[model samples]
Target: MRCVLIISKMQEMSNVLLIIQASLMGVSLTLFFALVLSSLQKTDTTKSYEIVRWLLAFAMLLFAVHYIMQMVFGFRAQGDDVGAVINILFYSPIAYILSYSILRIGCGNNYYRKFRIMSITGTVLISCTFVGGYLYYGSMHMKGALYIMGLLYFFSIVLFIIYPMKEIRRIRKMVDEESGQEPVLFNMYMRTCTKLLWISALCIAFSIFYTPLLVIIGPFFFIALVFYIVCFLALGYNIRQMSNIIVAETEDEVNADGVEAGTVAVKVVMSEERKEMTKALIEGWIKNQGYASSEINSTLLATRLNIPKRQLVQYLREVEGKTFRIWLSDLRLEEAKRLIIEHPEYSTETVAESCGFSRSLLQVKFKEATGFTTNEWRDNHARKS
Candidate 1:
């Protein structure tokens, strides 16, 4: 009687777990689909914004499809391998989409050819490894096949992360140095990368580490957690900031027939002649102490120069090869150095005002640029009055 009772108890538990699994998938499907619609409705004003937005939508759609598949195709028992197969198919692509989006934002189309080649090669190899191993042994649930899949995915994730990071760093350094713009801060990006790493680790664990007690329950909960987290990120990450991540193009890439990148919306190219004219105008403005004005910004500068705001921004990035803030800051820094050394009698407050820097900010920027604090630099260069 005890043996029969034990069997009956186990059967009841199994049924309850299955219901939970189904409920989880159903919830996931609904949530992901709603995210898809929300992403679609959002405005994508720039090319980079458009690409990332659509990719985000597509990735969510894939998640929705994945959950649908889990519910439809034998949502697994302890011995079943259907859920594993679904994960490999959808999870890898999700990682790819995310990594690729960042790559494009950082480097533009320069790395597109190489990225495409890698995508094709990786996909083929992973597919073949998973399919061939299953066919050879006629057992989809084989540990060897799943481990191989996980290993491939793990390595591939690492490779993309490393490669994209390199390109992003390189481009950021070059563009900032040339254009006087600050480099795109990777704080948020690093957080996203951390999430991607977690996803990869989970993929590997899900493949090889399974207990009979929590078979279906594990995958269901995993799917819900990851899917919801992704939805939040996709919906929450400020899309406007993406436009701020300017990717530089080479001479060959920026020429006629080449795509213009890193603009808010304006396609009006700053021709060399116009850029020179603007430079002359700006130099004259500088001579008149235009930068010393505390309340100036790119918009005001554009208005002052009689150029469109869009054109002015392009001019700064392309011709000036620096950001407006950097350019202005450098001008002020030079004035501060001059005041501190040549006009050493000037008060710190007077110097800061003349150079358009707050006493505090002058010190901060001076430290960053010259690796010495304002007082330290002044002490080293201080003249006998």
Candidate 2:
């Protein structure tokens, strides 16, 4: 009977250990994933915005490493000491700094220095309280330390929440001014992150109830890690959706074969009639004008065709898959080559002039368009004949 009781007790202990180990493993995995996604989010266009997010991810990674080491090494913080110290040192400062950067970016570039100083002051003040709490109540029970840490964290998290919201709103306003329309996806993603920040902050405050475990290893950290991972995935989805929409629009414009009224007519691949009309128009214009230098310019071509600028651009891109200037230069240079080879009596300068280019311009454009100088092109053609 005594042996059986001892075996049962040992089994119970083993089970408990297994549960704790599993939880720690889960948290570590979550932390690593958060770090990767957060790194991607660091690509914000503004340097100030990118820096704050980078610091937040860096601090969180450090906190994760500390937790993993403690879990594996059989370490426990006496009372709620660990939670208080980490909350002050890593959590509060990261939150405050990130918030301040958002606010500064929203307000304007000019306000960044002032907000940075304010964020630093907040970090210092909070760090002092955290250190003081630990030093003064080092020997106190877990409950006493928990109460002190909880109060300090509440204030810090509030500051963090308020600043980011104000800054995000400011960003929205600026975006609205520039684009002259509210960007739905951009605002939605920012709002989602801000909302997550609020929820994660609340989770931290709630985790104070589990102060003993929190001091050993906090659920707040794990929860924050998960929240950030979700935020990044959500943001990535929105960006991809926007990208897809832009690509679809471009493809649709290309597939439209005919001139969408007020545009230079586009040649349809299957419609020989429209293709013939387009070729005739281009040829007739070239033949009558005696090859002026202005024919190579897209803006000049669009004006001569009585077409809208955007339509002309789309027509050239879709039908030829080349820009107006490139297509025009190829045609002009090819004609110049034929003239040089067939009419040997024509001088190189005269051939260049007749093709609507100065002697130097002809040589440069010819070499750039084809991989050869005019003289080289002449020799290659003569050798072929």
The best candidate in terms of lDDT: 1
What are the models' TM-scores? Answer: 0.56, 0.44
Per-candidate Cα lDDT values, in order, are: 0.63, 0.55
Writing each residue's lDDT as its tens digit, candidate 2 over 1-385 gives 9999988976665455445545755665565566567557545344544454455556556556655654554233332355344544556665664465445434434434544665676667666665566577674334454555566667667766676576556444433322211145554555565576577666665554444444334444555445554554444344322221121123244336354444576453434564455556567777875355522444445566665545555555666776655566666777887798888677778887777777777888778877898888878878988
Candidate 2: the clashing residue pairs are none
Per-residue lDDT value at 29 in model 2? 56
Please give the clash total of every predicted structure, in order: 7, 0
Name model 1 segments beyond 4 Å from true: 1-35, 39-41, 80-82, 142-144, 179-208, 211-247, 250-330, 334-385
Candidate 1, residue 71: lDDT = 52
User: Where does the lowest 10-residue lDDT sum fall in candidate 1?
Assistant: 177-186
Q: Candidate 1 at residue 38, lDDT?
A: 58
| Candidate 1 structure, TM-score to reference | 0.56
Q: For residues 92-137, write the lDDT of model 1, one tens digit per residue.
A: 7776776776676656667656665776577667788878887987
